[model samples]
Target: PDIELHPSDKAASFSLVLKGTSDSRTTAYKDPARIYGSSHSEFTARKRLEITANGLRALAAEVKVHETNNEILGADTDVGGLFAGMARNTAMKKARERIPDAEALAARRVRERVASRLNQEVDASVTSINRRLRQGPGAALEQHGLGPASLAAHSTSKELVVEASLLFANQLAAGSPPAALPKGARAVVQIHESAVNNAIDQLGLAGQTIEGAHVRERIAQALAPVFGTSVKLPDDPEQQAPEGSITFAARAPLRVRFVDGQIEVILHAASLQRGNLKTPAQVIRARYQPVLAENRVTLRRQGDVEIRAAEISPEVVSISLQGFAAARDAAIGAALRAPMDRVFRPQINSPKAFTITTELGNVVPLEVTALESRDGWLTLAVR
Candidate 1:
């Protein structure tokens, strides 16, 4: 058997050719003949058969995509075992012609036996292949929300080819087509920024308040350099404040935007408190350059986080110098940077985050060969 592959921008084609030959010899008794007082004469029959089964036209499958349910239904052209039957018939005709006594009943029996065995072999091979397909790639595709949109098979001078177009289930409703796999890459997964934001939303990060004694302490420490006084952040908003201490709290959901080859994280609102006085909400914007190394992808902070202050000033703390707008913004940005880094680093930098575990319990470590963020999409090419 020979196998070949042809790949195009939209689809991939595969070809298989099965060819073999068999020989057999049979000893039988002929009709009674008077040969030196012998009642019957014996003859040896030999037959050599050559078989070539081309799956170019015989083996074909079509996959219909059901986007709503995220399912793929396959329709095989050889549902009736037509290819196996044809191969059996061809083998039988050739085997019978090779036999010395083609018209003999014995020859007919031999031909039938040869054809039956060939048919069984062909049928078994086809069945086994189909079973493996269903259990292997088929299962993987379904698990990953991938379905074939179009399937076609054809033959060239030297090969039989099967071509298919595949789609991602989640992208169908958005009318977004799958990107072409990069040259020499085994697979490519394109993640849109919107999908990332949606996942964040599903996790209930939006409107969620992040506050704790340890969290407040960390932020307070980060602000110490600019405040010139040790800050005390209350763990709860309603808790009584210590004298001259300032409280800071940030609210999510954090939204991400991919553009200009970077990931921009926006924290919509943060508030600063000094006793009963609280400043208006502020926005924090952070940008990161995504970096891929070995099997891990991580984000490197591009620069200092941008702090957008509201009309009310955060410099009203009695322990700090008043009316210094720039100093207040810098203090808030510095306080949030470390906590944000802690939140994102572990999530994206781990190698296990990108590893794929297959249904057979095999771990496939993905080595990201290329990473690109453009046009609101983050694409990763892996081998």
Candidate 2:
């Protein structure tokens, strides 16, 4: 697989394509865990941790929820997906029942009320903290260049801790049942011990290592038990944030649901295209960038020759396909030739969908589509 990253300014984003690769082959060769199993212990452990962390995160979630609740309720608030997540959970249902027509207008209203009450409580705490940091005791620090104790500053600081904590808590609470361990789940099932152990460990430790790390970090200085673990949570948006730049992390491979089964493409490269090939002294010569750090840039790139067919009218096929956008200069040239003379229409290949067109600006659709880079050019029957 060839991978390349062109800066957005340098080029329009290219969708990577994998040819002659199947999920079976990938599963057997690349990621067996994804194909056969996942971290079940981590998942189970997460549920347990979420329950424990609820108290920790609730303190923060409540404040932020309160701050935004009133504003959202008063405005055109849509809690459309907020509670959609655990709609099956009884706690969520009961929480929503406090407001009538939760499926309609009242869901946001209920949330608003909750958020408003919590906001008032948060405001009170902020006020108390500010007073102490000001004249109560820490006046010396504020007077010096160290820090100034203002209610706003105190609220901001508290907000960060509470917000981060609540964020983790909400994740924990997300799939939680009204109670833990339903009575019927105590059966001793036949399964691999390693698998069961793995699942359990995931359920217990994954969330803490990933998101709960923030709370652990904030209390790091004072807590002695928390050793060797950094308080900084990697998934937290605010932590280590470069100014004005947001970071998005990919935890796993992107699973694409396809018609036959499912096709998973591990795109190590930003844009996946079949590199153009030229032979230099019996070696394939192509110049392009490979996505992998180890294979960053290739001096002479060689790639498989793809089949391309164009079916535009001889007169205007050149203008129609060339003018239409393309993946490469070769694509533009192939479309300009209008080679597919016998088919019903000009067939342009696309991985997800296919479009058929003519020189007269008429378009026909085909179910059997092809990838843009897979084939060079195949002209179809022009209607």
Give the clash count for each candidate.
Answer: 3, 39
The local distance difference test score of each candidate is 0.46, 0.23
- For residue 165, give model 1's deviation from the true position in Å: 17
List candidate 1 stretches off by more than 4 Å: 1-181, 212-252, 270-280, 294-296, 310-327, 344-348, 352-366
Decoy 1 TM-score against native: 0.43
Leading candidate by lDDT: 1
- Candidate 1 — what's its lDDT? 0.46
Where does model 2 exceed 4 Å of error? 1-102, 142-383
lDDT, residue 227, model 2: 19
- List the lowest-lDDT window of 10 residues for candidate 1: 65-74
